[model samples]
Target: MFQELKPIQVETLLETNKNETPINYYQCDSYVLRRDTTNSCYAIYVVKALIEILYQLRNVLFHGELVPNKGAQNVYKEAYLILKMILDKIR
Candidate 1:
């Protein structure tokens, strides 16, 4: 899980989280990455997917596009990726 985060992957997650870039260059594909990385990958989705989802979330939140519900876990999941990134950096 946490073991699956490469330095670049961590950085990419944080960058996407901070900058709200609805894209990720680090991950090839979520479905494939879910298999390529590890079965219990660090994020609920691949780091790439989390980044894109978080960026979209920030956009929706910033623009008042819709009331927050349903996918709130996605943001929390992104936060988890951040924490994992920090922890991995520490290690």
Candidate 2:
């Protein structure tokens, strides 16, 4: 459940793209993900969130919604770092 996640984890999930310029999908719908504790691990929840964010980014890029820029790069970097954290926890 989300309650089991560390404060920083929840905070990161909630606020990672709050300042992304040109706006990414995550900034509008961070609450779209839910705590599906009945059938998944905490890592899966995080991974699912990551996937959702990435999918949104992919859609934006694929559709030419926003020109790639430094802010977009930062979003990618943040994703990679979050992914690394999840991998570290699982390993």
Error of 1 at 3 (Å): 38
What's the alpha carbon RMSD for model 2? 14.5
- What TM-score would every model get versus the actual structure? 0.31, 0.39
How far is each candidate from the true structure, as Cα RMSD in Å?
A: 15.3, 14.5
Residues 1-91 of candidate 1 have per-residue lDDT tens digits of 6667654443223223222243322444453122223344445455467567667766877798867776876765676688679579979
What is the Cα-based TM-score of model 1? 0.31
lDDT of 2 by residue, 1-91 (tens): 7767656544333433333353332424536333323453344557677778877877887899989899998987787787678679989
Q: Against the true structure, whose lDDT is highest?
A: 2
Residue pairs with clashing backbones, model 2: none
- Model 1: lowest-lDDT 10 consecutive positions: 11-20
Q: After superposition, how far is residue 6 of candidate 1 from its true place, in Å?
A: 29
Which residue runs of candidate 1 sit more than 4 Å off their true CA positions?
1-34, 37-45, 68-91
Candidate lDDT values, in order:
0.54, 0.62
Candidate 2 local Cα displacement, residue 76, angstroms = 2.6
| Model 1 residue 77 CA deviation in Å | 8.5
